[model samples]
Target: MGLKAVLSKWFAAWANRELEQIRHNAVQLQQATFRQLIQQAANTAFGHDHAFTQIKIYEDFKQRVPVRDYEDLRPYIDRVTHGEANVLWPGKPAYLAKTSGTTSGVKYIPISKESMPEHIKAARNALLSYIHETGKADFVDGQMIFLQGSPILNEKAGIATGRLSGIVAHHVPAYLQKNRLPSYDVNCIEDWEQKVDAIVEETYQADMRLISGIPPWCQMYFDRLSVKAGGKKIQDIFPNFKLFVYGGVNYEPYRTRIEESIGFAIDTIETYPASEGFIAFQDTQQDKSLLLLVNSGIFYEFIPAEEYFNEHPTRLSLAEVELNKNYALILNTNAGLWGYSIGDTIKFTSVNPYKIVVTGRIKHYISAFGEHVIGEEVEQSLMGVARQQGVDVVEFTVAPQVNPPHGGLPYHEWFIEFGKAPSDIDAFSQQVDQALQQKNIYYTDLITGNILRPLVVRSMKPDSFINMMRAKGKLGGQNKVPRLSNDRKLADALADYVI
Candidate 1:
């Protein structure tokens, strides 16, 4: 092993010890985190308004603060954006993470100085944990790339403001700066296609090993690389490439295509990161579930997913969460977001170590005919059937076709872009429909009662979804198509690209 690899192994060993302590003390750590966050932000305007001084327990917090999404929190966020101090957290925020929201348009999430390190730490620890477990640290010596947004930041009320990934780019630890690829100039390119082209040119011949990004964009980079290298597989171009780090969307749907592009399977690390805080990361190769960061600067609450839309849903603290039940995740972070819902649903796979798997998005589901099918179900159904049929799917999305133009009963419409088409598309579609029905009983009831037909599969031309995203100006850099939608907005838009 090289000197850097040896040093990395030592660091990983130390980091894993700390992580082991956190895992063992998960409940106590969360309780302490909750108390600390409350104490730290007690003097902020939000805290004062919520009567933080009087709050003594989790119940007290539950009674004082109502669960809120970005819209409900906008008034306070607006004040902060305009240079108000102590609106959310104590003093001014260190940075504002600008992200796109469906209903709220653009949202500016605070990243306080106290909470910023948690993001960096969580990301770093995820890698270190991998090295500790797998004893693979040689990747540290080769070129690493994180296909992400521009690093350029614009000042908003004297605070740095930019996409979360862009903001994170500015904080890459100095030690890795020499090994990071796609130079800053290429990273700053605004247009995604131009940026990918530039990245391809810069790293095509380099010793890439650890490549990280959302799966779709990473696939794009790999595709561009293959073409530039005259159809050579990614592994052929960069023999040292070992690990794939991905988040934002489930990697299963893209896994087959990604591995095919690389000409071999690679180890991967999954993470659960959001603008609010770094929530969790995969801690072991044996179990794919991510370990919730209990010691991080965030206190978590969960509302049963079924009860999320109720007038008053039951909220459970970390200790109260049960394994296998879906919960709408809520956050009370040191960054000053209180009783905030980021709209993602997760299910715990293991309670001992507090490991979880992201189930779906609360808002992103197909329920036109009373069958609430979520992102996880759709991904599971399609990917399961695809594997059975030996098919390769590049991308896909599901939406309810409430009113079919041909006048059939309402049904779910699947828009799929295939890398390798199934030999019998009809049979493949039927199998996927059956798989979904098995996963969602309500969908089965609807289909059996004739209220809705089996899902209709619409094969999309190659690059169709990519073109749609490009048209909407959401191409690349953490952007991903929603897996399921209740409305036909996306379904109708995808019509133009159907083969």
Candidate 2:
């Protein structure tokens, strides 16, 4: 066998064995792993004072380390950035990934040398797992394109800082870097649109086999690539394309459009890697659920989503997390993030092997009129309606119009950016309304009882959401339009560009 093929086979075999072990004893590994994580960082300033050494199980750990958000731990992170030894972790972090969500301008997430291996291993093993399960080893031999954020690194508070993806790109294994496309120069462009233009020029006709990135940005790349290929499908540009590896956003809403762009079916892998840590990935194609990363250097916790925003929440360990409840994710990592509320919500699909689906963000919810609509409902409803309508959704957000223009009762206002605008706009709105009502009974009752009007749909002029993101300094790289908002915060900003 050729050298590349031989190496791929070896790696696949190793990963398969590891996956088996993880599946067999996921809960045990999870508990033991947290204990190890505490022990590993026990001497660090945060851990030593918290009595990490005395904590033997999940309950004790929870009692000691209360769940905290990024702002709550910002002081310690500041200490780490300023070169304080053992402030949060031992010594200093190797890098601090800068992540900005809908509201937070930028939060520096520590990447410790001790925890870096988990980050590296999770990424590699995810791909290897895909190869083992799907027998798709040809990608390793051919080019892979990462529609990454700027590779521009800045020295901030005595640490290297950039988007997590860029930091990861900078650390791509030397061997594989040789086969990755869109040169470093193209990857360095700060502007999202400009960078996409450069990327299109760099990789349109390359023999690329794998593509990875956030869905919205990758869609931008694919859209431009299709145009550059003279309106040909993605398969025509890179015939050997085998995988669409993605994270940072749900791919369901974009799947139909992406498949249409690619012109054929291909294998896909989903990961739930956040700035805090690598959480989960689609381990086997059979389940279509993300297997939790028990072996990664992070201890996990889940707070029931309903109680998460309350003053006190009941925190549960992997063993206690029940299936089908939306729980806000929490973590204590070897990287020195202790009991940090990651702000994302997830639901356990399977507890045996510990698989989960990200349901929404803790802050991304709408309960303006007691109708609690979350990210999952909005995404699933949109996907279902768009798929049935034979249309492509670009970007969307829903806000309760508390102040109705005609002195009527309050109602939802949907601002959508459509790649292919649907004909019969009223029918499209009805479909969207029906889909949401089917998913959320409260929403249905609000309309059925005449408490709220049918949702108002306003198709946005193309690029409005992009402009909004740009205005907010969150143009790309993991930042997303909040799927649902309690107030007209984003809706007011986006309505100016309605068609």
Candidate 3:
């Protein structure tokens, strides 16, 4: 093994030991984090407004701070953006992570100096943990690529502003700098398709091993690479490619097609990262659940998903969270976000060391008939049937079809793009609908009670979703088609491409 690989193994061992300590003392660490965040931000404007100085415990904090989304916190964020000192966190934020919001247009989430290191560290520790468990560090010596937004930053109110991925691109650790690709110039291309082409040209012949990105975009890159290699599988183009790291969306939906593109199965790591904080990462190959970052500079709260829309929902801290129940995740972080709801929902797989799986988004669900079907349920249902039928799904989305043109009964509409269409598509659709009904009892009641009919599947043509996203100018960089929507906004747009 090379010197770099040897050092990686040693570092992984040391990091794993520290991680074990953190795992053992997860609750205490979170308690300490809560105290420190409150103490340090006590002088900030929000702190004063929320009575932070008088707060002594989690109960006090909870009573003083109500759960807030971006709109709720925008007034304070506006002040910070206008160069006000000590508005959110102490002094000014180091960077503002600009992201697209559904209702709020654009959001500038602060990445404080104190909280930024944890983001970088958590990602590193994920890889180190993998190395420690698998003892596979040779990939560290080969080319690594993280398909992401441009590293270029534009100044917003004198603070660097860009996508969270772009800001992180600027902080690539020195040791891995030499092994990272495609060239910085190529990464700066404004268009994603052009950037992928550039990336393919630059790294197709290199010893590329570790490939990282959101799954859909990774699929795009693989498609381009295959075409460029005259239809060679990704593993043939870069035999050294082993580890597949992904986040931002569930991988199960894309796993079959992605593995097929690579021409074989490979080890994969799933991470749960957002502009707010690095929440969790897969620590073990045995369990797909992500180990929640309890010791990280963030305090977590959970409101049961079903109660999220209630007038006053019950909020519970990490210690109070239970297993197998979906919760709308809330955050209080060193970045000065207090009781911030980032819109994602998660379910704990294990509470001992606090491992969780991203269930879906709080806002991204279908309930047209009062039968709420979440992202996890839809994904699990569709993928389960797809596995049974030996079908490969390229992409899919679900939305309620409240009005039928022929005045037929209302039903859920599923737009699916398949790599290999099932011979009997009607039978396939029936299986998927039945799977969803089994997963959600409310949906079953609606179907049997004549309130709704079985779901209709619209098999889409090749590149249908890709064309839709491109037409909407959201082709890449953390933008994803919502798995399910309560309304027909996405379904209407997708109607143009249905086969």
Per-candidate local distance difference test: 0.93, 0.84, 0.94
In order of listing, the candidates' clash counts read 0, 0, 0
The stretch of ten residues in a row with the least summed lDDT in candidate 1 is 366-375
Write out the backbone clash pairs for model 3: none
Cα RMSD of all models vs. native, in order, equals 0.7, 1.8, 0.7
Model 1, TM vs. native = 0.99
Q: Write the per-residue lDDT of candidate 1 for residues 1-499, one digit (tens) a residue.
A: 7888999999999999989988899999988998898888899999999999898899999999999999999999999999999988999999999999888998999999988899999999999999999999999988899988999999999999998899989899999999997899999999999999999999999999999999999999999999999999999999999999999999999999999999998999999889899999999999999999999899999999999999999999988999999999999999999999999999999989899999999999988877889899999999999998889999999998888899989888899999999998888889999999999999999999999989889999989999999999999987889998889899889999999
Q: Can you write out model 2's per-residue Cα lDDT over 1-499, one digit (the tens) per residue?
A: 3467569878888988988877788888887888788877888888877898888877788778888888888888888878787888888888898876445657889998877777778888899998787776888888888877777889976788888888888779887988997898888888888888988888876889899988888888888998887899998888889799999888887787788889987789998887788999998878778988888888788889889878888998888888899998998887889889888999999977788999988888878877888999988887787878777888888888988878988888889889887887788888888998998999899899988888888999988888888997777767777788888878889978898
Better of 1 and 2 by lDDT: 1
Clashing pairs in 2: none
lDDT of 3 at 393: 95
Best by lDDT: 3
Candidate 1 backbone overlaps, count: 0
lDDT of 3 by residue, 1-499 (tens): 7899999999999999889977788899899999999999999999999999999999999889999999999999999999898988999999999999989998999999988999999999999999999999999999999999989999988999999999999889999999999889998998999999999999989999999999999999999999999999999999999999999999999999999999998999999889999999999999999999987899999999999999899999889988999999999999989999999999998878888999999999999888999999999999999999899999999999898988989999999999999999999989999999999999999999999999999999999999999999999899999999998889889999999
Query: What is the alpha-carbon lDDT for the whole of candidate 1?
Result: 0.93
Q: After superposing candidate 2 on the true structure, give the runs of residues whose Cα lies further than 4 Å from its correct spot.
A: none
RMSD of 2: 1.8
